[model samples]
Target: MANAHMRKKEPDKVRRSLLDRTAKLAVDQGPAAITIQAVATAAGVTKGGLLHHFANKQALLEAVFADLLKQLTDEIDRYMAEDPQPFGRFTRAYVRAAFADHKLGVRSPWAALSVTMVADPGMRRLWSDWLDGHLAAHRATDDTPLLEIVRLAADGVWMADLMGQDRAEPRDMTGLEPQLLALASRPPSA
Candidate 1:
């Protein structure tokens, strides 16, 4: 009976292992490099074992995408919890989280999974749905232009760093956070 209980937990472990391996491959070699056999080999599991957890490559990539969104959402939530101001909390938290991820050498799953999204329409729809839901949940009350600008700038900074375009000796992307936050704090102009 104890063994049976333990067996139930094993699948989740195996699933996580497979997803981690797939994410690594997607980061290191691009999503094109992710295949059932390749992921299984990278994860030290047989192809059958990987398939048991993920019905196919699409399923595996979907899981990876979902996990990535969850991590980002959780990080943003943590930042929001620390921020007192309600007006700019979402954009501020987003910028801070992106910088934190870069400092920690964490690769965004969206970069890694882009190929899968391009290859599979279903994956794109899944991602779109997730983003739509996230935006709906975190919708800003004021909807100021500065908030949009700050978010766009943050995305540009993140993309530049992700693509190795930010050639500064010390990455100080966070330096812009205060300025953006200031803009976010102001009331919309008449």
Candidate 2:
């Protein structure tokens, strides 16, 4: 019983440490440098120690992505909790967070890691599935073009940043926040 409990606790600690290391690597040098050995070294662990928790580099990267997804999901949750009346508040918060200061906020990790998907379709699929689920859950209330537009606009901003576009201006998202709130808060079509 003691050994089992220690095994459980130790793995969680190692897993968290590896994730923190990977996120730092991702932010610093981008996800392309996120390797099992690299993360192990960064986390002050041996490769075998990292492998004990992740089994492989792909698994570690997935955990990194999972960590980012959870953060974004939690952000959404907190925003929703503040105003549970209509889902618009959730949507508005998303836009504000996404484009606030013309930056992707904490979601910058997702954009950085997204490039790795070209080398790993499974990672791409995982992200796609998560996005699909979110859309489906909102489809009923969204039930119209407004939600689709928001999704597209949000994606456009990301893509623009990814492509290094030099638009008229970065985005001025702060100015657009109120417009997004108005659109999302409007009563759904009868």
TM-score of each: 0.78, 0.80
**What lDDT is reached at residue 76 by model 2?**
69
**Could you give candidate 2's per-residue lDDT for residues 83-138 as a string of tens digits?**
76665555655665556424654346666676786568878887788777776776
Winning model by lDDT: 1
Tens-digit lDDT track for model 1 on 51-166?
88989988888888888878888988898899887877777787787677666543656666755676788887886797667666667643567877887887777666666634
Worst ten in a row by lDDT for model 1: 1-10
For model 2, the superposed segments whose C-alpha errors exceed 4 Å read 1-9, 87-90, 100-107, 165-171
Local error of candidate 1 at residue 80 (angstroms): 0.5
Error at 131, model 2, angstroms: 1.9
Cα-lDDT of candidate 2: 0.70
